[model samples]
Structure formats: structure tokens, C-alpha cells
Target: MTAFTAWQVWGRFVVNDSPSWTEPASVLMMGWFILLGSAVGVREGYHLGFDILVVVLPETPRRVLVTISDIAVTGFGGAMAWYGYQLAAGTWNNVSPALKIPVGISYTPLIVGGVLIVLFSLERILRRLAGLPEPHLEADPADSVA
Candidate 1:
């Protein structure tokens, strides 16, 4: 994506003939990147949330709240997958102006990411039920910059 943006800038400023395809291509790529990145975040328990309340709760209540949260996430993921499929299917015949690719291609990431979220959430619930360690919310020390 960076390379595409750089090429776009260079083409416009240096070559004086910017390609029309670059903008739409970048938009499509960014959509995929965001959706997939969100799925990875869900799997890693890295998604944003307010944990202050949960953190203050007692152990049993915390467990219950976590379970409830996981169930909610699973439901949300399922809904996204279903609606994303409908959207993709509905726009399958529509083509982009510049790339001429089917408009549905841009929505594929949503469906895939939704499915991944569902799978990951289910695994988390299962782990919780099996008495496995709770997923940590702490940021990785390695992510810290000097």
C-alpha cells in the first residue's frame, strides 16, 4: 500500500501522468487490510475496550463477564459474516470504474474476517470453559519502544 501511494505521488509530481487506477486500487487494498487486521486483533485479544469495570470485579463475576463478552462477540461476528455475504452477492455483477473488478471483491475481506472472528471467539470460549488461563489484556512488553 505504501509503494502504491508512493508511485501515485511520483507519477503525479514527477511523471505528470497519474494513473486513474491507483486511487481505487489503494482504497480496495486498505479495506482488506483493515478488515483482516481487525480479525487478527480479535484473535489476539488486542481489540479496544474499556476494561476498568471488569478489572475491578471479583474473580467469579469477571469470569461471567468475560463469557458474556465472548458470546456477544461471536454473535456479532456471525452477523457480519451473514450480512457481508449478502452484500458481496448483491454487488457481484457491479464493476469498478477504474479497475473493472467486480465490486464484490472488495467485500471479501469482511466475510473472511468475520469467519475468523467467530472461530477465534469460539476457541476463547472453549478455553475458558476448559479452565485454561484467561486471555491476557496487557500489552506485550516487546511492543514498547525505547
Candidate 2:
């Protein structure tokens, strides 16, 4: 993607004409990067969690809350996958102006990311239930302020 963008800039600045495909191609690349990165974040527990309640709660309730949160995220992932599938199928015929590819290809990342998120979240929940070690989680932001 970086190389493509550089080509775009070079084409515009040096050649006096930007490649028409670059902009749409870059946008598609950005969407894939962001969506897939977020799925990886789920696996790594990099997303923020409001754990103030969990910190103060009793062990039982804390576990309960955590399980519930994971379940909710799983449901959200399902929704994303379902809707994304619909969008992709619905737009499969629409061709990208510059890339000449089906516009639906751009939405495919949503489905991939959603499925990954669902799998990762379920793995966390199962590991928690089985008393396995937790996933890798980022440290709290407040801890670094010193």
C-alpha cells in the first residue's frame, strides 16, 4: 500500500498525472489493514476494557462480567459478518471506477475480520472457563503516566 501511494505521489508530481487506480486501491488497502488489524487486536486483547468495576468486584462477579463482555463481543462479530456478507453480495456487480474490480472485493475484509474476531473472543472465553492462562493484554494507560 505504501509503495502504491508513493507511485501515486510520483505520478502526480513527476509525471504530472496521478494514476487513476491508486486512490481507490489505497482506500481498499486501508480498509483491509484496519479491519484485519482490529481482529488481531482482539486476539491480543489490545482493545480497551473498562475494568474499574472488575477490579473492585468479587472474583465470581468479575469472572461473570468478563464472560458476559466476551459474549457481547461475539454477538457483535456475528452481526458484522452477517451484514458484511449482505453488503458484499449486494454490491458484487458494482465495478470500481479505477481498479475495474468488483467493489464487493473491498467489503470482504469485514467478513474476514468479523470471523476472526468471533473466533478469538470465543477462544478467550473458553480459556477463561478452562482456567488456562489469559490472552496477551496491553497494560493500562494509567500505569504509564508516571
Candidate 3:
């Protein structure tokens, strides 16, 4: 995305006319970036949440609430995968005008992100069940995969 954006800028400023594919490519890359980032956020529990209730709850109730929250996230991931599949399938035959790629390819990240979210949420739940430490809201930078 950055490369495309830079190319777009250089083209427009230096060449007077931008490459047609750069804008669309950057937009498509942005969609992928958001989806992938969101899935990783779920894995790291990095997304913002209203934590006042959980913070005030007793340990047991807080655990229960956390479990419920994880369940809800899993459900949301499932919905994303299902709906994304439908959307992608519906648009599979349509090609993007700028990139000449199947438009459906743009939506493929949703399915991937959804699956990742579900997996990560399930891991959290399983860890809780196993009496292991649950994932922290923010992962240690050194502990994260590159």
C-alpha cells in the first residue's frame, strides 16, 4: 500500500498523470491491511472495549463476562466468514476496472480474518478453561510473531 501510494504521489507530482492502477491498488491493499490488522488485534486483545464493568466485577463474574465476550467475538467471526463468502461468491465473476483482477479477491481477506479471529478467540477460551493464563489486552512486542 505504501509503495503504491508513493508511486501515486510521484506519478501525479512528477509525471503530471498518475498510473490508473495505483489508486485502486492502494485502496484494495488498505482493505487487506484493515482486515488483517483487525484479526491480529483480536488475537492480541488489542481492540478497545468498555472495560469499566469488567474492571469492577468480582473475579468469577469477570471471568464469566470475559468468556461471554469471547463467545460473542467468535460468533461475530463466524458471521463475517459466512457473509464474506456470500459476497465474494456473488462478485467472483466481476473484474475490477483498474486492476483487471476479480473484484471478489478484495473480499477474500474477510474470510481469512474471520477464521483467524475465530481461532484466536477459541484459543483464549481454551486457555481459560485449562487454567492457563488468558491472553493479555496487549501482547509484548518481543512475544509477537513477525
Candidate 4:
């Protein structure tokens, strides 16, 4: 994607002949990157959240809240996957203006990433139920500065 952007910039400024395909291609690539990155964040328990409440809650309440949150995430991911499939299917016949590729291709990442989130969240929930240790996201204490 960076290569495409560089080529686009060089061609426009130096060669005076910018390629129309670069913009749309870069956008497609970025969309895939963001969707997949979000899935990875969920898998690693690195997604953004307000942890103050969870931290203050007692252990039992915290566990219940965590379980509820996980179930919600699982449901959301499932919905995304299902609706994304419908969206991709509906747009399969449509082509992009510049790239001329099927527009449905753009939605592929949503379906893939959503399914991955569902799997990862389900795994986390299972581990919690089985009394496995919860994954921690704390940074090393030594790494902190005064």
C-alpha cells in the first residue's frame, strides 16, 4: 500500500501522470488491515475498554461482568460475520470504479475477522468457565518511570 501511494505521489508530481487505481487499491488494503488488526486485538485482549470498573469490583462480580462482556463480544462478532456475508454476497456483482474488482472483495475481511473474533472470544469464555487463569494485559512494573 505504501508502495502504491509512493508511486502515485511520484507519478503525479514528477511524471505528471497519476494512476487512478492507486487510491482505491490503497483503501482496500487499509480496510483489510484494520479489520484483521481489530480481530487480533480482541484475541490478545488488547482492545480498548474502561477497566476502572472491573478493577474496583470484587472478584465474583468482576468474573460475572467479564463473562457478560465476553458473551456480548461473541454475539457482536457473530452478527458481523453473518451480515458481512450477506453484504459481500449482495455486492459480488458490483465492480469498483477504479480497480474494477468485485466490490464484494472489500467485505471479505469483515467476514474473516469477525469469525476469528468469535472463535477467540469463545476460547476465552471457555477458559474462564474451566477455571483457567485469565490473560493479563499489565505492563512490566520495571518498565514504568517515575
Estimate the TM-score for candidate 1.
0.87
Between 3 and 4, whose lDDT is larger? Answer: 4
Query: Candidate 3, overall lDDT?
Result: 0.82
TM-score of each model, paired residue for residue: 0.87, 0.87, 0.86, 0.87
Error of 3 at 7 (Å): 1.0
| lDDT tens digits, residue span 1-146, model 2 | 99899999999999999999988888999998998998888787665554667666676787787788888878888888889999999999999889999989999999999999899889989988998865343245676657
Give the least accurate 10-residue stretch of model 2, judged by summed lDDT: 133-142
Model 2 root mean square deviation, Cα atoms: 3.0
| lDDT of candidate 1 at residue 59, scale 0 to 100 | 73
- Score each candidate by Cα lDDT: 0.82, 0.84, 0.82, 0.84
Among residues 3 or more apart in sequence or in different chains, the pairs in candidate 2 whose N, CA or C atoms overlap within 3 Å are none
Report the lDDT tens digits of candidate 1 across residue range 1-146: 78888889999999999988888899888988988888887777765543556666777787787778878888888888889999999999999888899999888888988898899889888987898876484345786678
The 10 consecutive residues of candidate 4 with the worst lDDT sum are: 135-144
Candidate 2: which stretches are off by over 4 Å?
135-146
Superposition error at 97 for model 3 (Å): 1.5
lDDT of 3 by residue, 1-146 (tens): 89999999999999999999999888888888888899898787765443556656676777788888889889998899888989999999999999999999888888888888899889878987887865463235786568
